[model samples]
Target: MFFRFLFAVPVIALFCLPASAGQYDAQFRQFLKSDVAPAARQAGVSQATLDRELKGLTPDTSLPGLVGPGGKGKPPKINFQAEFKSPARYFRDSQFNALVPRGRSLMKQHASALSRIEAKYGVPRRIILAIWARESGYGSAKIPYDAIRVLATQAFMGQRPEFFKGELIAGLKILQNGDVSRTGMKSSWGGAMGQPQFLPSSFLKYAVDFDGDGKRNIWSSDVDTMASIAHYLSAHGWVKGRDWGYEVFLPENVSCTREGPDNRQAISAFVREGVRRVSGKPFPANEVNQPGNILLPAGRYGPAFIATENFYVIKDYNESDAYALFVGHLADRYGSNKGFAGKWKPMKETTRGAVRNLQQRLEGLGHDVGGADGLIGFKTRRSIGRDQEKNGFFATCWVG
Candidate 1:
């Protein structure tokens, strides 16, 4: 599910005139008429729908990450001055403990429907529940914004206005289809709507009405929401009978630089090289012959994993490795209610700027740190490891 914090362009700045708060209403209305209406109309939305939905609509300038009227403000920074937390904090056992009981209960409550959903979609119920808890606290999280207003506001003044422009049109199309009322179509400030937190585009493509209620009502229907999330994962190529990953013990002799999807090999190969499940159980027979890759989210300073192709499939839901790992770990806790056996070792606190400097240094030596983005992605982590090996030190694959 994409978080749609939407944004806008410059020549159109002339329409803003004085660009004051009061005038923003006038400007937004103009934008709807001039920019949005035609695109929405071309996409089969009626003139009546346009006039009715857009009448008196105004921009929400208070939304975070806006870049001013014409997307002219500097992009938001990563708060480089703040200390980056370790995985121990991110993957707090109390946090998972609190979530697991509810997840287990929901699993039983929805067991029948979930079974059918799993049968149809080939996605496990546990994974679906984990994603549900993560996305919107299993529909308990409030999603209170008018989706049209949020999308329209984003299209008018937020960053990535063109992207939001498309989303705004899609939002209008959702309204025109009568799948949801304009008033009932609540979204986050960023425009990810309903329980599954689907963007309008995602709703159109993947949402399913499993409850037979004639609406893919992610807002209030637990069954529909669960099925919709399952449908999303299935569509994204979630492999049946495969686990996302396994917590593992990586031998000290193995380099952490071997992390990432591109470095995948048979799980059997990893076991042959001395990787073993922290549980001491063998890799599942179904998984042993299939491909897997090293995954050290905090490099070697945290728990080690041998992630499957299914792990990357989960990542397709949300790009962050931490997010995918969290979902996988949470799903596991449904059965065992245990945390990772391997510990997340402590490291010195460092700023994003400091990390970026390290990344830049690695890039200077012709290593690809994935554009020196300051965030330590797999490329950065592995680059650090490779650099360490080059300098005759043990490769930790992390920012020291």
Candidate 2:
């Protein structure tokens, strides 16, 4: 549900509808009067608020990934020809280096408040800081769009119109509550509001008034922003006193096919099977008996990790392995600025269509690659490895 606003790696070039030129203004008003106002009223928004806010509102056709009035055109295309970078480039040391110092400074600056947040929420401050940096560059990124306008536009014209319609209603409710003025409620073009990049529904559920300002002002309050992120993670099952994951050395005999959260075993089981921390240290005593699963983000081409359940909790914030790994690794870097122990080998450039083709082949042979979404999630990675094993080759868990 969370979409990273400022720190996304552009894998697909999005297409926007041409500028509205007021072409859909009449339809948009009809939609508000007929479809939205009733729902907003059900959700406790007043008729006066609707009249004052939505009057003369035109759909913002210039937002990215638009697909006409009802997703009528071919849904936005994945730029199948876009460049695909290897994990080495994606997790370059320089990227972390650029973010670490500021993160460290912020960590110290907010030490007392962070201690209280951890005490109350059981999420580490570093994790909250890392997510903050990733979501909006620790509140440095500009969020310029009006949240209601963006949500209303998406509900009227963008892909997943019904979903955005719900968010639009939530945005109106936020306004009706007077949490923020409509003019001050800024958001990304995608309608992820404020520094933590929460959607309107998420803001309603998780935003808090941490600075005692009597309003959950995520737009300008760092305390509110950090606390809100911690609250979201905690609500999604952030395990107390546990870390996300650790980089590890996987022996050659350890098949990469043994990947994914579904294949979880005790951390000690992986250790007994010859996994070792890349730091040459033992797993924490508390963690040794806890469940973890192998995470091979780049199969055998990049770093290996034994990810704790807490790792998946981070994934709930953004459902991407790379995004979770980036947050986890950056959180770790707030204290120790080390890079990965296992190097990411260079990969041949491939496209989403190529990956989809490979997934289809694996699926035909009775492997589930998580719906052939053209992304190399754990299911796809392990499916590749399993196919290699079936062909009597070493399973690198990577695309050949």
Candidate 3:
């Protein structure tokens, strides 16, 4: 009876374990076979490749923001009470200071290759270096997940599985392309692959074999990575011999409400309106008659700029005004190493819920709050400036 009790205890413990832990394993395999295989095969993936890669594949439930099968598992609401930082926090000097030396070193190290890429692609070596530093910390950032697994899991259960489904097929095609082995194709949890962090589709379209190797290996080749980034920017219309934009002193007479890509005026026109480069130099002679739009990122409360069309091209790399500015500013610092001339005014920390409430109020008043997504975009900033102007007050265009 003592021996029987011991065996029974072990059996009971085994039965008590959570079934949900590997609950999706069978379902995930079936999904790969039934759902993914047809599309991947149609995209020229072979039977052996599918059978090899899909074997024992299981969804990684631990990945953040997953929704379950058929939407039965409701996604958790975003924690709106989380602290929302001012845009100024993103431009901290310490961040730029740390990146400068490393970028300049890479510029010298890869000078020959970067020179070639620039002659071919028309993107500056510094801009390429800044993007490289920002994206992967010059390839030091740990990208630890398997690209195949990440694409597979996200396709199965992540918030945008349909979009990931397409990327998953693209990823398999990349595998079929023989550029990198499955083991070597490391990625972020979101499946942005390799040092330049090209999505699998971007890899197919823009990745280049700069080293003259048969394969476009962005994973371990500095030449391929740098060239690939240049190619992407160039394809997206990076104009040669142009800086992204210039920081400027916006006089009080120039209304902050005039901020946006749509409100463009010639550099000469801006100079006529009393906008001066923060550097106190004249706007570049070549750009004087060229169009520029006012970019008041923190509204009138922060440093302002007259951004050129090249600034929007950088925005194509990452769709945020702050992101483009960081890349461009960092690129400039490699030459001069100076921080922004204007100050980011001190502001109290507020919750995203509070910001969302403000956006909702703006929306109710028929202002475009850029979808009330709790994050402030240019639309929200301009609407605030317009409202402030309508109320017969100086328009700060930023949150109080």
Each model's lDDT: 0.84, 0.87, 0.82
Angstrom error of the Cα, residue 41, model 3: value is 1.4
Lowest-sum lDDT 10-residue window in model 3? 1-10
Error of 1 at 350 (Å): 1.7
- Per model, how many backbone clashes are there? 4, 0, 0
Best by TM-score: 2
In the range 180-221, model 2's lDDT, one tens digit per residue, is 898899999989999999999999999998888889989999
User: Per-residue CA lDDT of candidate 1, range 1-400, in tens?
Assistant: 6432111000111122224577577767788888899999998889999989999888877666666666666655434443456667668899899999999999999999999999999999999999999889888888889999989988887778998888888888888888889889999988999998999998888888899978888888999999999888898898899999999999987789999889999999999999999998998889999999999888888899999888888888877788888899999999999999999888766766778788888889999989766677888889999998999999988877
Q: What ranges in model 3 sit over 4 Å off?
A: 1-20, 70-72
Comparison by lDDT, 2 against 3, better one = 2
Note each model's CA RMSD in angstroms: 4.5, 1.7, 9.6
Sort by lDDT, best first.
2, 1, 3
TM-score of each: 0.94, 0.96, 0.92
- How many backbone overlaps does candidate 2 show? 0
Using TM-score as the yardstick, the better of models 1 and 2 is: 2
